[model samples]
Target: MGERLAGAEKEVLVEIVRFTQKNGLKGAEGGWKDFLARNDKKFGASVSDPKKRTKDVLLAFLVTFSKDFQKYFRKLVRRHAERRAIEQYMNEFSGRISPEQKLVQLTTEHLDYRKNYYFPSYQEGWKVMRIGKVSSSMNSGAMLAIDCEMVLCHDGTEAVVRVCVVDNKLEVKLDTLVNPLKAVADYRTHITGVSKKDLEGVTCSLVDIQKSLKKILAKGKILVGHSLYRDLYALKFDYSRVIDTAYIFKYANLPTTSTASLNSLCKSVCGYSVREDGEPHNCLKDAEAAMNLVTAKLKHGFNDPIEIAENSVPEPDQMKLLAHRIPVYLPCQELLKIFSGNPSIDEKIDSRIRGEFYSTCISFNDIDEADKAFDELDGQETKDSSGRLQKSVLLKRDNGDVAGFFVRKMVYGSRLSNSEVLKKRPQPTENTEQKKEDANGDNRKRQRTSKKHAKKAKAPVVE
Candidate 1:
C-alpha cells in the first residue's frame, strides 16, 4: 500500500483495475467484488445500516463532487500521504468507501470535505468521464435533455435549486425544485426563478434527482442538454453519452471553444426566446428548447446552420462578498455598536446561523473596518455589559481544550475572505537593515562635522 501511495499515479481506483487481466496482468482469483469484501473495513463506513448495505440501496448514497471539492480532497490525500512518510497511517476506513459514495460524506466532516463546494457547480463539471465512455458504446440512439438551476450556499458554493428533464419527443419527464443539503447562499431568483418560499417544504435531495435521472437513462444512454455537462455535474451523476446543444450549435463569428446559450439558439434557430430580458429562467422551457434545438440539428444532418446568429452570454457574478464565523454569540446590535454605531449591516440584523459561537457568522459592508472592530471587541480589553472596559478577557475558542486545532491557530477573530485576500495581497518589499545602516552613517557624519566646526571656532578664539 505504501509503495502504491509512492507510485507515479496515486489514483487508488485505477490500481484496483490494474489487478485484472483486462489490464494485461494475470487475473486475480476474485475481481472487484472480492476485493471490496476483503477491504470492506477500509472503505466502508464504520457503522452503516445493515439494510442500506444491499446492492439496490447503492443508489441512495451516490454523489458527484465539485471541482473545488475534488481539488481539496487530492490536496488532503497528498498531505496524508506525506504524513505516511513519517510513519503516520492512512485512515483504516478510507478505502472501504465505494466511488459512488465518495460524495457528500462531508455532510458532517471538515477538511475531509474535498468532495464538496466552492465556485458553484455550473463551471468545471463534466470534462472527464465522457468521450472515453462514448468510445466504448458507439450505438445508443436514445437521448434526453436535462437542465438545472442553482442557488448559492452558505459556505460560498452553489447548490441545485431546480432540475428539469425533457425527452426528444418534446415531453417533460421531471421538473422539480431541490432542497439544498446546505443552507442557501443566494436564491438567484432573478435568473433561477427560485425563491425561498418555493423550496420551503421541498424534501427532494440530490440523490433523489440522481436516481430519477438514472432511471430515465438506464445505461449507455445519450443525455442531452444545453451545457448538459454542467447539468450532469450539478446532478452529480456520471453518464458518458451526451449531446451538448451548446456545443453542437454555434453562433456566427464565434470560436468553437465558446458555447452558445440556450436562449440564443432558441431565438435564432428555433425562432423563439426561452425568456424575456430580466426574467427568471424556466428550466423546463430551457430543457425543452435544448431538445428542440437538437431536433433541428438532427433535421439539418448535424451541421451548424450558415445563418446562425449570435447572442450574448449570461453575465458573471460581480458581488465579491465574504463572511466571518464568530464562535461566540455576537449579536447584530453589538456588531453595529462596534462598527462606529453605523447601520453597517443596513439595519438588517438577520442570521440563519444563530444562538451559538460555532453557528454564528457575520459579514461586513466594509471588511477591513468590520474586522478592525471585530478584533477590538474580540480582543483582551473589551467593554463589559455595564459599559466598563474589562481587561484579561478569556479567548473565544478558549474552552479549556487539551490542544490547539492548528499549528498557527487564531488567538483573535478573522474573516474568511479577509484572510484569503490578505494572503493574495502583495507585501511591500523593504530593506530595513540597509535603511538602518544608511541612517547610522548619516548620523555619524553629522556628529563628526559638528565636532570639527566647534573645535576650529574655539581654537581661533583662543589664538
Candidate 2:
C-alpha cells in the first residue's frame, strides 16, 4: 500500500535477497556494507547514498521480500536435496536392474513421497549423476598387476627395495627402486640382482612410494599378482581386493598347504616359461607374466589344468614316477609278496631306507593305471606276527602328486625294528662334552685378552 518497486529497484532488490540468502545477514559484520559497495556502481544514484536507500526504500522492500526470499531459498534447497536423493537411490538399485528393463521403478511411485520425483532410466540416470567418472584426478579403478623385489635388511627381515605396477594391457605404470628405511644386510643378488651400488643414489622413501601407489590404485581395484599377500605385507598395505595367481592355480589334487609355483603354473597353464633367463627376477616381467596367465585363464574360461594334463595321454616310458612310503620293519620278502599280487605294481619300484621309514618310488604306464593301483592298495591292511593290523597309506607330494604308500602300524607308529630304533636314537659322547668345556675355556680367554687390550688402548699417549 506504500509504493510499488520500479523495474530497476526490483532487480536490485532481487540481487540483495540472493546475496543475503547465500551469505546470511546474521554474524555478517560488514555483509550489508560489502553488498552496497559492490552494487553501488550498478545501482548508480538510486543506491549511491547508503543511509537514504536503507531508510527510505530498502527497509520497506526487505520487510516485504524477507518472507518471499526465505520461500525461494527453501525451494532451491529442496530441489538440490531431491537431486541427491535420486542419485543415492539410483546407485543403490544399479546392480539389481535387469538388462531388458528400459526404466527402473522407484521404491515409491509418488515422487513427492520419496522426495526424488525425477526418476530416469538406469543409463540416463547414471549419465545425469556422472556416476562412471571419479572426482579424483587419479587413475580409474581398473585392474592392475603388481610385483615387488625385496632385500634382506640388517635386522634379517625382508624389506621391499623395488616395486612395479602394470595395467591389464601389460603397460608398465610404475617401476621404481625404493630406498630402505634401514641398512641392507644382504643384496640377495642371486634372486633380486639388487646390490648396494644400485641403491647408492636412490632417494625414493617408502612413504613416497605409498603416495605414488595411492595415486595410481583406486579403491575396489582388483590387484593381480603371484603371492600378492607377501608383496602387500612387504609394502605394509592392507588392500584386500586381489586375484592371486597362486590361488587360481592351486594344486587341486594336493592339500591346501600346497601351491603351484608361478613359473611352473605359467609353463603348465599358459604354455610359456617365466624367469628362466637365469637373471634375477624382473618385477615388470613378472607382472606381465601374471597378467598373461590371467588373460589366458579368462580366454579359456578357467578350465581345470588337471583335466587338461590327464587328457594329453603320455607314453608309458614318459609317465612320471610316484613315491610311496612302506614300513621299515616289513621284510623285503614280505614286501615283495604284497606287491606281487598287484599286476599294476611295476617290477622296478625303487626303495630307500630312512629313520623308521622305508620310501618306495613306483612308476606306472599312465596316471589312470597308477590311480587304480593306489585306490586298491591304499588303506589295505596286513597282518603281523602278533595279529595286529598294519594299514598302508599313500603319500601326497608337495605338488599334490601321490606316488607311494607307507605301512602304518596301529600299536606303534612306525615298523622300525628294535636294532634300527636303537641305532637311530641319539647317543651322548665324551668328545661332545669335552668340546663344550673347550668352547667355554676359549671364550673366557678371549674375554680376558679383550679386556687387557681395552685397558692398554685407553692409556693416554703423549704427542
Please provide, for model 1 over 1-463, each residue's C-alpha lDDT reduced to its tens digit, 9 standing for 90 to 100: 2222223233332322322212222213243334344547665543232222543222111112233434433433343343343221114444443221121121112231222211122234422222223222333456677889988888986789899887778788898889997888789899898899988888998878877876777754567777665666666665444566665543433322234567766776778889888888988888888878777766664344333342234322001111223333444333333222132332232222233321212334444544354334422333222222222222222233221010011112122244554563444456998788888999997877887675643211100
Candidate 1: Cα lDDT at 117: 19
State every prediction's TM-score relative to the real structure. Answer: 0.41, 0.40
Number of the predicted model whose lDDT against the real structure is largest: 2
Off by over 4 Å in 1: 1-137, 302-463
Cα lDDT of model 2 by residue, 27-124, tens digit: 22234445455546767343433334644344333444444444433333333444445456446665543211101111122122121122211111
Error of 2 at 161 (Å): 0.7
